[model samples]
Every structure is written in structure tokens, then in C-alpha cells.
Target: MSEDHQPETGEDETVIESYVAGCPIDPELAGQIVRLADLPWNDRDVTDSAMRGLGWSDDEVPTDEARFVTAAGHVVYGDYCLYLPFAHSYDVGGELWPDDFWGSLPGWSSQRGAGREEFEAHVDASIDRFAERLGPPECDVRTEGRHLAIGRYSWRYAAWRRGGNILVIGPALDGFSYAQDEEAVVYIGEFAKDSPFPDAADFLNLMHT
Candidate 1:
């Protein structure tokens, strides 16, 4: 299932929140992330234009700042997902950084296959890595044995707040006409003011975990 649409939960449910106080960042920087992530994920150019309209520059995205390129041809750039469609995104807490995203880039080439178990282990390690930056996660859990469109799957994830935006480190998976593959992934977004769900707990309930 695609999370392309906003969902409304039927009733009150527990919300996930971090009891640990978040480390602070420059308010302006946090605002930029919030605004950028709030843009529609369906289009890169559209999102870029919207970000620019709101005074964001492509230079501000953390891909380069964070050195998110892999020697394996995978990249963690904004809109990279548009080119590489993953099958099991959000299926479990995190995804595989699937070998599917491996392809030729100007100065980059990928092996086209990475050990799934190894990559998944790396995804799980992200919580501590992120904690180093964002202080502590508001919520981190392994939702094993959760039902999905395919079958039961288990994944772990961690969430941190960078100001108004909610950042999550989770495994991703997806299936298409040809095959299925997993991807390493993270998420940063927030509920809209008019959103039906208020916090992570409410929004996550849609997963029915």
C-alpha cells in the first residue's frame, strides 16, 4: 500500500512521544527542514520550486553535508525515491536500502546486489547514530510480526524531532510489476494543521501494529 494519501484514524489511540528532551538546534534551520519535508513527495521539481519559493536552496539539503552516498551506487538525496521505487517501504520499521537502487550515476556505480541481512542490520543501527545528532528518539521500537499487504514482516525504527518535523529511521520495501526489493530509508514529516491525526502514535495506528 502506498502512503501517498493522508489517512484519518477511526478513534482515539495512543500516540508515540519521546519523553527525553530533544537537543536544540538553530530555530531557522529546523524551520527549513520542516518546510522542505512538508512539500509534496510526488515530484522533485515541484517540491524544489516550492522549497525555493519558501527560501530553500538545494544546497541546504543534507545529502552532501551528511555524505549520504554509498560506494554501492545508492544515494540518499531528496527525490531519489522517485527514480528508485521500493516495494516494502514502511512495511517494517526500516527497509533494505535495497540493491534495486543501484545504478550508474555520473561518477558512481553500484554492485546491484547487497546482502539483505547485512543491510537490514545497518538500518537498525541508525537509531544510535541519529541519537548522536538529534539527542534521543521520541519513539523507537521493533514492530515484528506486523501484517502487511504481503504477509507478516518485522522491522525496527526510531523517531526524532527536529523542531516541528518528525524524523524517522525505518526500513523500506516495495513491489511492482516485475519484482520486489527493500531499501534503506528515513522519513521527515509532520501532520498538517488540519490533519486528522495529531502525533506519531495516532498516525502510526494506521499501520495497525
Candidate 2:
């Protein structure tokens, strides 16, 4: 079946709850649900094996997508159905680094907004820091001007890196405007342990859970 097909568990009622509440669905749970829906048989042996492989008990697993919304009202959508874990933010300070005593560089201004050059520099610095902490395998960087394609939004640029696995960053937007000037936001996504760019829906689905 196509990846976009909603799992049997994702009912209209669940969609309503997610929309009204603004809660994200859990992707991990969704993955399990999708697998269950696609199962050829309902036999105990077959179900048990699949559940075991997913590291979940049948009862613990969600039967449909409706069960995904959290009390906070986050809705998981897309391949992995992963939610944006924390509120979106351009302020990477405390989130990405806690004890590290590094400040934004002089040439880089998160305030003036980052251009291609500035963005590239910032990502390079981030790579250096990431490497220092995790050690490095491989890395690459790219930048572009504003452009809109998918949907109506315009992405400033896109960056992809591969070390132990794939790490994507870019198309940073005006978080304040998007969140009504209340919350800062940035779009970042990680792929499977060693995969490049996750199956979009699967990745988003995982985040929701």
C-alpha cells in the first residue's frame, strides 16, 4: 500500500481531536499501528511475532491513529508521524548546548537574519561542535537563496550532513511570525541511524509518538 494511506486506527474522530487540540500523534505508535493494519492474518502467532519485532505488546500498541494525540494536543502526521518535540525555536542556545560556554559569533547575527554566507558559517560551527562531542565520520554543507516550492512556504536553504548518520538542517524561517511572535522556531529532522533523509511520513510519524 502507499505510505500515505492512513492506518486503520486513524479515524475521522481522531483527526478531529488532533485538529481541535493541536496535539501531535506519536510516530512510533503509528508505525506499529500501520504494521498491524497491513498484517495478512490476525492469528496470535503472526501478531505476536510482529509485535515482538516492534518491541511492543499488542495491548500496549495503539490500534488506530486516533490514539496518537497527547493531552497537550500535538498531532503527528507524515511518514514517521513524529511531532516537533519542543516548541519551535531559532534560539539554539540552551536547547542544543547546555553547559557549553559558546556565544553567537560577531559576524553571525541571528537578529539581522542569516544570509547564505552567515547560515553556512553557523552550520559549519555547529558541525565542528557536534564533531567535538560525538566525533566525526563525514559532513557536507550547502546553502541557497529564498525559494518556495512544496506547499506555499519559502525555505531559505537546505543542508544535509552524513556522519554516523544523516542530519538535516535549514530553511530556517521567522519563528516569531509563524508562532505569533510568541515562540521561536526552526525546522530540523534526523533520519534512521544510517539512512539519508527519512521516509518523510515515517519520520514525522515517529516524532509524534
Candidate 3:
């Protein structure tokens, strides 16, 4: 069920290499994560460029969990998705996330599609990288219950607040799904504000999430 669209090119791989100038990331993928996370639902042009520039491809037809994958068909890299806001919609950041379906929250996330050992190794590398890239985490982010399990939800994570962006990397995302064995992920998102209903910043976050 791949998309009609083909992946861009090696440019995306190039970018990852640049960012990986060897660090990994709670913020291990810091530069890329923040840039992708901050992109709202409506940001199609930038999102496309960003994803392609990061080696993502629509070739791996979107699934229930991801709109598009970072390394479309890469085996060892695991499955990663950098979800962006919809192009045509009236959603503007509001109503909070998961609890409100029509809310403007984006799930900028990734999970290791490899085996348990590979996944653990990847997560370990990221933690080690984050220690050097951005230091210790700010706090631990956890899901209260099934209510927070919207889209790809996170159950618990170590958080790092870099200005308006929050980098959360650890276990969860599938917070309460029946297929809950999958663990280890990274989520970068913006801090939500109490904006009035229908704010432009919403960017159709509802459908995307």
C-alpha cells in the first residue's frame, strides 16, 4: 500500500548524516527533531522538504500509525515518521491534545522497527548521545491512562525542554494499545498555549494526530 509518490533522494540521507556528526538524541537527533516537531499541520511545503531532506518517503504507504515514514523501506534504521499538518483544513492549535479529537496537536514520532536487541541498542545510543548533545532531561513525561493514547501515544518518557520545544524520548507511544509490546521512541513537540478556539496555529492538528 505504498503511496503513488516516490521518495525524494539521498538528500535526506545526507541530512541525517550531517545531524549524526555523531550524536544520537533524547535530543540525540536534536536538530532534526526540533525542526520537524515545530512544523505544524498546515506546513506542507516545509514538511515535504524537511521529510525528503531527512530521507523520509511516501513510498511506504501510510499506516494507522504513520502518515509517512522517514526511511521508507530501510530495514536496520527501524520505522520512523515525521508527521506534518494537513494542507487544507481549519484546525488551529486548541482544545488540548488526545482528549480533544479536533485539537491541533501533531505526533512527531519514531519507533524502532527492528528486533528487541537492536531497539534496545538504538535507545541506548540515543540516551548516550543526548547526554552529550543536550545534557540530562528536564523531567519524566507519563501517560495517566488510556485517555492520553491518541494517535501514537507515549506512556512514559524523559523530557527535555529546549525553549518552546519539548524533546521526549524513551518508552511508550502505544501507551495503551492491545499491541503494546513495541517500546522505545522519540517525540518532539511544541508547548501548547491557551489560545481561543480556531486559532490559525492549529494547523488541522486533529486529523493528523
Candidate 4:
């Protein structure tokens, strides 16, 4: 079947572009992925269960939102790529990582802990791992405060370059809750000097894939 003739899922699951040489990701798409990453899941356990329901493989799922995938059938938003088996509490009527819940986690009293620090370090490691799995680029890790809080949950941000473009990855804010207990939510997006899509057809070509 030609790429243009494929069925439309209408679930915001269409691809926007193909792998182009030297082409960079669009800023609009990158912003959208960042918003998606900031989306809150009810809790970690619910997120895990959602992944299972989505039929994602075990390895594709992670205990934190610091992973990326490079496959044909994977989900794409602008320059961002999403792996399956992720959970979004937005579907279940729960806020992602509500602030009140952070107090419940052990060692989270002051927003600093071995666990929190470890989580941040893990995120750094994940970015490096993703670069190895995808490709190489300049890498940077940024944080706003001493603690990594997304919404109710704390998280860190990691950005890297591949070719002439930049890709950002991180966990969603308010992605954690006690009732649901979501571990993490991963998000990816790209930034480049020019739009990756040369024209409308180029964007559509990505959808066909």
C-alpha cells in the first residue's frame, strides 16, 4: 500500500515527516511534545497498566519517563518520538503529579532525597542511553531548582543534538499520584534551523508511514 493510502486513526497518531538528511525538527512540533510530556498521569501503577493495555513490549516501557524509541510504527509528534505502553492520567480524570501527593513519598520531605537524586541521575543516564540507541548529538541537562518536580512529581530535563538538530526528553509534571502511583512519563521533541518538512506533502508523507 502506498503511504498516502493508509487508514487514518484520527487519534493524533499520525507521523509528520520522514528521516531526512540534515533537516531539522519544527519548533511547533517540539512545543507540542513538550506539552505532552508535561501531561500528568494519575499514578505510576496506572501508567504501567495502561502500557500493558496498549500492547507495548516490556523493554519499551521504563520505570521513568527518560526513554526514546526509533522504530517505524512508533508514535511521532513533530521531531518528538513516543514509545508505546505509556500511561496518561488525563484519560482517567486524574491530574498528573499533583503537588499535595509529593509529601507522601518517603524521603521526599524537603523535595530532596537519595531517591530524588537517584531519579535525576537515572534521567541523565537515560539521555546518554537514548543517544547511543538513536544517534549522537550535543547533550545538555537543565534543572529549575534543587528538586526535580514535574507537577506533583519531580523530574529533570535532558536535551541533546543529533546532526544539526536538537531533541529534548523528560518526564511529565504531575505524572505521579498515590492512588494510581505512576512511575514516569517519557517525552521527545526536536529543534532545528528549519522545518523538517519541506512542504505539505512532506508532512503527509510522514503520516503515510
lDDT of 2 by residue, 108-147 (tens): 1122222334433443444444344335524332322224
Best by lDDT: 1
lDDT of 4 by residue, 1-209 (tens): 22332323452333221110011123333333333433223244544443444443345422445332222222222223342212122112124322222222222221211243444443555555555545543434333432322243433444543333334444343323333222222333233445442222232122212
For model 1, the stretches where C-alpha displacement exceeds 4 angstroms are 1-114, 146-153, 175-177, 192-209
Residue runs of model 3 more than 4 Å from their true location after superposition: 1-31, 37-45, 62-65, 72-122, 140-156, 173-179, 192-209
Alpha-carbon runs more than 4 Å astray in model 2 = 1-114, 137-171, 178-190, 197-209
- Residue 139's lDDT within candidate 1 is 72
Q: Write the per-residue lDDT of candidate 1 for residues 16-110, one digit (tens) a residue.
A: 11111011123343344445554555556765565456443444332452223322223334442212111122211113221212221322222
Listing every candidate in turn, what is its Cα RMSD in Å to the true structure after a full C-alpha superposition? 15.4, 17.1, 15.6, 19.1
lDDT per residue (tens digit) for residues 1-209 in model 3: 11211223432322210000011243423555556656652456766677678776665443444545543232112123332221111111122211112111222222212233444455556655555666775554444433321233323345565554445555432232232233355554444443222222232231124
User: After aligning candidate 1 to the native by TM-score, how far in Å is the CA of 18 from where it should be?
Assistant: 36
TM-score of 1: 0.43
As a whole number from 0 to 100, the lDDT of residue 204 in candidate 4 is 17
Model 4 off-target regions past 4 Å?
1-114, 134-137, 146-156, 161-166, 176-185, 190-192, 195-209
- Compare candidates 2 and 4 on lDDT and give the better one: 4
Q: Score each candidate by Cα lDDT.
A: 0.40, 0.29, 0.38, 0.33
Error of 1 at 126 (Å): 3.2
